[model samples]
Target: MDRAEVTELVLSAKRMKGLTWKDIHEKVSVSTSPIVVTAALLGQMRLEPNEAAKAAELFGLPEEAQILLTEIPYRGSLTEIPPTDPLIYRFYELVMVYGTTWKELIQEEFGDGIMSAIDFDMTMERQPDQKGDRVKLQMSGKFLSYKRY
Candidate 1:
């Protein structure tokens, strides 16, 4: 089956089993980070063979799907240009609003360079607030400075 088909199967099984991404991540014991493991299952990342096998067992996926999980996926291939989804759109909006500010601050602090998404780690937590529960996101990525040629 194609990656998209496998994704569909996985989503179907997850829904039928009433499983959360955390549930699958912990049960499969694939990665320490739930986000990474979830992304692998959602066809954005690759899992090692052993990890893929464990995920297959947890999700009741077939052999082909398990193999597909181990294959490298086309990351960010499914994103819409402007992001039609509200939650995703908010993230897009954040970048649009803060993109320059972030760039300027980073450049000033770290010189001319960029953050490496390939070598990144992120965490999401709920911050307790009397006004409302706030979403706290912490992202750490390696900084790659430009090389003088």
Candidate 2:
């Protein structure tokens, strides 16, 4: 499927009920935009093998949709959002909320720069909480220096 078709499919999933991009963000293991994750639901975006597998089970994407997702896509923002449509915006929210901590920690670990989401690794877990199930995201990316090193 193309971008439009995929976007629709992602937004239409029963599993997606009551889920916001924020919920998905906390379940990741790396610094990626929620757009990337939510867009993946459309079967238009590529996912890591394990991630793809998980999505397949969760969303029941058709075989073609699965294949199409693995191919690099012509990316776009569904709305007037910056590098964001609906899917990616969820990830941006995390950065906006916990960005200070992330910025500080990355600076402490590497320096003043951001990590490469393209060359990153992430893992997620679900923990039972008093209020609800909490998602634990653990991510490690090869940090890139904002300036010439």
Candidate 3:
């Protein structure tokens, strides 16, 4: 099966078993963060051999599914340019509004460089508040300086 088919199987199995991303991650012992595990499930990352086997077992997936999981996936599943989903759209909007500001600040602080998503860590948490809960997204990526040619 292709990565897309495997992804659908993973989703179906997750729903059938009522398994959370954290649950699957813990069961598979694949990643420290559920986000990474989720990324694998969504076909954004390749799973190691052991991870693929464990995930296949946990989800009762076919043997081919395990093989498929080990293959590198075509990342970025969004079909449209600006995401149609409201939650994702907000993030797109955030970048549109603050991307330049972020670029400027980072450039000023670190010189000519860009943050590395390849070496990044991200976490999401809910903060308690009297009026309403607040979502906190924390991300840290290594800074890569441009090499002079």
Candidate 4:
């Protein structure tokens, strides 16, 4: 099966079993980061063989699907240019509004460098607020400087 098919099968299995991402992540317990592991199941990232086996067991996936999980995926391929989903579109909007500001700030602080998504970690949590709850996200990525030849 293709990676997309495997992903669909995984989603179906997750629904049938009433499994949350957290539930699967906890059951597999392979990666420290839930986000990374979730990305792997969503067909955006690759898992190690052992990790794939664990995920397969948890999701009742076949061996072929488990093997596909261990293969590198075409990252950022699923989303449209503008991202049609409302929640996803908000992220695109954030870039459109603040991207230049972020670029300027990063350049000023780090000097001709960019953050590495390949070596990144992110956490999301809910913040208790009096009026309403807030979503808090923390992202940390390694900075790579441009090399001058």
For model 2, name the residue pairs that clash. Answer: 29-123, 29-138, 29-139, 34-87, 34-88, 34-91, 35-87, 35-88
lDDT (10s digit) by residue, model 1, range 41-131: 8888888899889888977889999999999898896457899999988999999999999999999999999999999999999999999
- Judged by whole-model lDDT over C-alpha atoms, candidate 3 comes out at 0.90
In terms of TM-score, the best-performing candidate is 4
- Give Cα-based local distance difference scores for all models: 0.88, 0.64, 0.90, 0.89
TM-score for all models, in order of appearance: 0.94, 0.51, 0.94, 0.95
Query: Candidate 4, residue 64: CA error in Å?
Result: 0.7
lDDT of 3 by residue, 1-149 (tens): 78999999999999999998878988876445788878988899888889889999988999999998888888888998799999999999999999999999999999999999989999989899999999999999999999999
Give the lDDT of residue 113 in candidate 4. 90
lDDT of 4 by residue, 72-115 (tens): 99888745789898998898999999999989999999999999
Q: In candidate 2, what are the lDDT values of residues 1-149, reduced to their tens digit?
A: 57566556656664466656666444532455665676565543566655554444445666665556566776544555454566577787877899999889879988778888778766667899999998788887888888664
lDDT of 4 at 53: 89
Best by lDDT: 3
Over 4 Å off, model 3: none
Clashing pairs in 4: none
**What is the Cα-based TM-score of model 4?**
0.95
